[model samples]
Target chain A: MSRFARPHWVEKMSSGMAKPLIGEISAALDTLAATGVAGAIDLSGLPLTATDRAELEVALGSGEVEAKVTAAGTSEIRETGFAGVWWVRHFDAGGRVLAEILEIAFVPQLLGAQGDDIDAAARRLRTELARTPERETGRETVHAD
Target chain B: MQIDETTPNAARSAASGDDRTLGALLAARGVSRRAFLKYSSYLASLLALPASMAPAMAASLAKAQRQSVIWLSFQECTGCTESLTRSLSPTLDDLIFDFISLDYHHTLQAASGHAAEEARMQAMEAHKGKYIVAVDGSVPVKDGGIYSTIAGMSNLDILEETTKDAFAVVAIGSCAAFGGLPLADPNPTGAVPVTELVTDKPVINIPGCPPIPEAMAAVLAHVLTFGILPELDSLGRPKSFYGESVHDRCYRRPFYDRGEFAESFDDEGAKKGWCLYKLGCKGPATSNACATVKWNGGTSFPIEAGHPCLGCSEPGFWDMGGFYRALSVPTGDVARIAAVAAGAGVVAGAAAGALHRATKSAARGKHHTVTVEELEEK
Candidate 1:
């Protein structure tokens, strides 16, 4: 299932629009960024391949956005929009993963028997993300003149 | 694959006197370096050590021997044992045999009754002054200690007998550490922690409802290798694992700091995995490795599993209050205005009162004012 589909239930209760869900996703990514989870994944799965990273270069160019093969599972952020990756085994693709990503994570230190580095990375990434200047998206001012 | 060698220098000298690398050291002792290093690296991370210490730890581990452990079950459920035995990674047996020798665990051992008592006695005698004694459940000291007994002896007597010559006494589970459910208010059993009963020996209390299995294993390791207990907090819990509050390490801590809280169980906060403190999460006060170490094989914990903390590790946790009652935290700068307003009101009232007095005094002090009015006055 698509990652957005989980939180999209809230959107179903909306006026049949997905903007609320998208907003939730944005907030979730922000929180994750504050926690050192910096990248974003598109759950619609456009037949992504090893080379598709280059094909989605336009999306990747957004600076806040990055794409890679996340471990198959919903990253639940709860209904505003977006999903949190369930385990770090998926984040094997993060920070430049290697071949047999599954093997390296399953080696016991990553997530299975013992948890590793998720806390430090989350703190570091989130602090760094919070400091970035807002990428203006036209709603900068709705002030009452 | 389990190298139970405890002579670092011997293992080194034995391996052609080459002192570098777990590869060479374990190879000298006929243990696979990969397997040893693999476990060592995992243990190092569990202790929150940097990646650089992996080699040194592995090398030192070549001489790490399995200390004989006699598991003593006291007045309680077998949850702690169950938590350890069910570990999914290397498995708890791997921990028991590979690291420390579990000489006699009543639940896991095949022997029972007279044979079980004999085994425990032998373990204490054979490994005398060197064995590790792990106690689960609390010791009921009331009514002549008749509340719980093993082999016709009260738990208090058994603990005293078993721990008399032990290297270190470890209190596992909340029952043994902080007196689990049996310790709740109006404790008829008069349950007391092992630390209360064992005054002669050093006791390490791993006090959770059931402490994370890795935490249990880590304590055992530090005890075996260093021959010194890990630095413990004021409550006798090892600082490496119980140093910080679960809330401090929780993933939802940010939401909490921002003044957001889960208002209800099934609300958006639960879905967002936001802070559950407002909903009476004891993470702020209770200490354990739950947030980062997690559970269900390091996957999640009570908060992540969408439950508030019951404060199982803290003393008098069961009686202090309900799990859902918001702990009375200082209302922060948010309520500072009340005091400020109070001060302002006192000053304002005094000023008003003083102004009236001053007006009366001026009239009384008047020398040439209102002479005609004085004449017209009756």
Candidate 2:
């Protein structure tokens, strides 16, 4: 009979650092429970190892929502099934990881566009349209109904 | 020295004799059970109570008798009342106004002078040891509090005498809670907060230049439903509303993390929506629901509007070395502790990262080239 060795994945999952991370997340959830306020855990601020990050990902699996928003760069937001917790990752224009945060909110504010920005964009477009010649733009003119 | 009633509404219904429960009032006003339950759930969410507690809260609030409340205004700008009145129709403020029998308010009550005092005295005598006292503005203790008086009575004396038989006292604004702007440096009136004088009764401080209307309503709802005061922090503020620092939950926090700060109010970084740390946002030291609950029905907060936080909710904020000074420069223990904690977190994180990487090999797997399209697909 041959004895079996522990799997590499199992070895990678068990780490002393994982305990504190779990504790921090638990406390954050407690804050959410006591105050309707959301919390954020900045992964960039944390000393997270590849193995630790991987372990965390495995433990807190994704839920129903997964959103990828593009603005100055790209931001990917994923909600965990547990307690409205979210995993938000922001990337710069160069596609480099800018920030990795664990946010707790009903909706991730990072992925949602700001109302002011949307208003600015619309105003810019209207100004540009007014400046452009209607024939050159190759679009039908809009009229109020 | 009896004062005549100016309006017929001055002779309001006797608060003690009106035995109609809040639920019956709502029913009479054509409010449905479902709507009340929904409002209760919203309040629960705002109060940070569990979803399970909503039905219980609704039931309790429904059966609750209208409690008598005496609202006192002194050494104030009436901004707190203005903020409360700004709430739209059917808002929590309106609901709370409906829930409680506001027996006396110098600003809102039709009664004035001795008539107003008479109404207040009647309510106090009728519901002694049970009525709620909501106070705005600070009590000027200097020269026997002559700086601010109502009906020729000092604010200090009136507050002391009125709250003597009160169940609880709700300090409704930063002025009444922490002496506010009037208590700033070189305070001539010797303004003091309610917590400083009324130590015998439970005093809940809802501190803000003009506190969020919903915050006041939430505290009143908690008291009316549970017949007890909500859990408060060491600062005598409700823990739920004043639990987290504005910096922690700010929308621009990611910009702060990236070390992108707007040096000036009108700079390019400001236009690009960078962090306001360098511009002197007191968010790090201030703890309030402004970031989350927001103002004017969740329109925006000070930080969201591109202005740095004034830390108006915190005590002594008016004297916190100018509102435009960076938080990096410490004014007190709170700012110092926050900076020290940040430094410690970075050190701890780096050390942990180094330890975890120590066990790994220097050589890693071959790099994989991926397109943006592929990432998008994933």
* Best candidate according to TM-score: 2
RMSD of each: 22.2, 19.3
Tens-place lDDT digits, model 2, residues B302-370: 888889988888877776556776643322333233334345432221222222123212211221222
Please give the C-alpha DockQ score of model 1.
0.02
List the pairs of residues colliding in candidate 2. Answer: none
TM-score of each: 0.60, 0.65
TM-score of chain B of each: 0.78, 0.85
Question: DockQ values for all predictions?
Answer: 0.02, 0.02
Per-residue error for B182 in candidate 2, Å, reads 1.3
Worst 10 residues of 2 chain A by lDDT: A1-10
Q: Interface RMSD (C-alpha) of each candidate?
A: 13.3, 19.3
* Alpha-carbon lDDT of model 2: 0.69
Error of 2 at B87 (Å): 2.9
lDDT of each: 0.57, 0.69
Report the poorest 10 consecutive residues by lDDT, candidate 1 chain B. Answer: B369-378
Across residues A1-145, which tens digit of lDDT does each residue of candidate 1 receive? 2111112222223332234334544564565657743332222211122233232222222222123321211111111112332211121112211111101111222222211123434666998787654533233544422
